[model samples]
Target: MWIGSAAVCLDDKNRILMIQGKDLVEWAVPSGGLQENESLEDCCIREVKEETGYDVQIIKNLFIKEGQAEGGIHYQTHYFEVKLIGGDANINDPDGLNI
Candidate 1:
């Protein structure tokens, strides 16, 4: 199973912060699979900073879901509302994804 965590941040105008990256896929909130021993909150914060260069604090868990994709790939994802603490809006994704 793929365990993931995503961060939800809103702009000053209350617009949702979405990212369009190298995948050329649909725009999505900053998210990724968790590393061993990493908490969901930590993973959410790390993914947001890594993908969008924004330091974030996990405010709360907005929702959690699990699903099975084609080819039997299962996923468990957690979404959290986050507060921006610092950092620029520039992208510097460790995975080479552009924001």
Candidate 2:
């Protein structure tokens, strides 16, 4: 099973913050798989910072989606509403994927 977390942030204009990695054709919220010994919320916050260069605080958990994909891979993703705390809007992904 693959476990992940996603961060949802909205600006004052109600525009959702989205990111597109170099390998992804579609835009998506800042998200990533959970790392060892890390909480889901931490994963969400870290992913947002890594992908978008934004520090955020979790406001609330929006929802969780769990399902099985083709080839029998099961996945669960937790979605959370977050508020920006600091950092500028820029790509600082250590993996060099986000653009």
Candidate 3:
């Protein structure tokens, strides 16, 4: 099982920062799995930064979900509400786009 953290990055305009994965082409919150010894909060912050180029402050844990995908891979996902601290909405990696 893989554990991952996602962010609903809300801005002053009430717009959420969503990302479009190059592979998936679906809009989703910026997210990624935790590294060894990484806290959930840290993972959320790091993932958001890596995917969206935004420094985010986690406000609160919002939801947790688990399910099996088509390929039989199980996923455990954690979602959090976060506020953007700094950084532009630039895509640091070509794998995804900040929308």
**TM-score of candidate 2 versus the correct structure, residues matched by position:** 0.90
Which pairs clash in model 2?
none
lDDT per residue for candidate 3 within 1-99, as digits (tens), equals: 889999987777988888876657678888888789999999999988888788989899999989997888899989999988898876776333433
lDDT against the true structure, each candidate = 0.88, 0.92, 0.84
> Which sections of candidate 2 miss by over 4 Å?
96-98
Give the runs in model 3 whose Cα sits over 4 Å from its true position: 94-99
Better of 1 and 3 by TM-score: 1
**What are the per-model C-alpha RMSD values against the true structure?**
1.6, 1.5, 2.6
Tell me the deviation in Å of residue 30 in model 1.
Answer: 0.4
TM-score of each: 0.89, 0.90, 0.85
Clash totals, every prediction? 0, 0, 0
Give the lowest summed-lDDT range of ten residues in model 2: 90-99
* Model 2 residue-pair collision total: 0
Model 2 gets an lDDT of 0.92
lDDT of 2 by residue, 1-99 (tens): 999999999989999999876877899888999999999999999999988888999999999999998999999999999999999987886776647
